[model samples]
Target: MSEPQHDVDPVRLGAYFALIEVSGLLRHAIEQQLQADGDLTFVRFQILRRLQLSPAGSRRMTDLADAIVFSRSGLTYQAGLLEKAGLVVRNRTPDDERGVTIAITDAGRALVDAVLPGHEAVVERLLFDRLSQDDARTLTDLLTPVRDHMRAAPPRSATPRRTRP
Candidate 1:
């Protein structure tokens, strides 16, 4: 069957494609650097980095999943792997037996410290190097509202699931 046509203008379509392409390219490079530098996956790195940056050096699993826009199951699996590797610890919350809190270990902080320099360099070279300071500001301004609008939907951890009857 032929696809139905939509009435999107050429400029908007082009911008959407360009944004997608740039996102893919940036993610690819960042993933490679994370793997090579810290033997970490991009998602794993994000998890550790967020924990490391948090004031308490930890976060509840659901909050972590929401912040990273990762599925709860996937985050649980990754947290298990990190726990096995001695990079993080998962604990049951005292107030809620069902809740899990993930905390970065010293080793995890060390790994993030090791990997950050290369990650920053890769991002700077691949993205910011092409944009002037003013251009960067303009890009942020243009994208912030779109990001906020998209995030207005329920967070990944909060989204309801469909059940077959």
Candidate 2:
């Protein structure tokens, strides 16, 4: 038997899936280039960039996790790998011995600075070059609401509410 055809929801059939598919493709492309430069992955790049922007090129471990939007454990693991690579170091807070800060080493900044031009080229080649100025502006406007709502989403442990009868 042949499959039946039905109306396609344009947003679902076209937009949403296309966005995710492009994201996967972009991730693969960038990761491939990054791996060639070294073993650095995109996630590690993000972490290093965040630290690069901070005081003395460092931030509290908790703050780094939040800034990178990675779970604490995930951030810790990534930091550990970067640490082993001598790209970062975990230091006990001088003021509060109980706390730790993640510092981007000189090598980390150097690596990111070196690789950024290549990464920027990939992004430009993949998406930006294909977009006209007007289209890029429109895309940014369309994404703002989704970005805000996601930023405001309830935490994972929130309780579900009951519907009224």
Candidate 3:
């Protein structure tokens, strides 16, 4: 329960402080708004939004998981909840019987359609409206590298080594 001790390095500390504050505030605002108006968890909202806009209104489970950044079971579980809520349906794909597909239900589409504008407004107020056009472009340029970095699979947690004779 000890506090994390740090040898202060101004450059690193400044970077860490800025990152934590910005990211924490952004996520807090997003989660609060999503809970208030979306009637769905962040992950469910993502899945439903994707399926609602997807061609043929469906996508393979693996692809959906990838796009939504959830583990396979994590996505599947959330999809199950949506199905129980009549928001999405799971069916076996004819092309790949082994793979499942998810499609948004009409009600799901309606739900997202109703919520999307509010979501957009929240996003605009939190981010876009605060920036000028030129600043937005510059922000996009600065963010692209960070986006690319996230797309790469992160390294797995390290395992401890045992000494050998």
TM-scores of all candidate predictions against the true structure = 0.91, 0.81, 0.79
Q: What TM-score does candidate 3 get on C-alpha atoms?
A: 0.79
lDDT per residue for candidate 3 within 1-165, as digits (tens), equals: 999997889997998798689778776776677788866777788898899889899998878877766777788889999999999999997976578999999999998887788778877887888889999999889878987786765322111123346
lDDT for residue 61 in candidate 2, whole number 0-100: 77
Q: After superposition, how far is residue 72 of candidate 3 from its true place, in Å?
A: 0.7
Give the whole-model CA lDDT for all candidates, comma-separated. Answer: 0.93, 0.82, 0.80
- What tens digits encode model 2's per-residue C-alpha lDDT throughout 45-145? 98888888876798887666665566777778888999999999998978776667999999999999888888888989998999999999999999989
Name the best candidate (by lDDT): 1
By TM-score: ranked, best first: 1, 2, 3
Ranking 2 against 3 by lDDT, winner: 2
Candidate 1 on 1-165: residue-level lDDT in tens? Answer: 999988989999999999999999999999999999999999999999999999999999988988888899999999999999999999998987788899999999999999999999999999999999999999999999998787788665745444336
Model 1: CA > 4 A from native: 1-5, 158-165
Where is the poorest 10-residue window by lDDT in model 3? 154-163
On TM-score, the leading prediction is 1
Residue 11 displacement (Å), model 2: 2.7
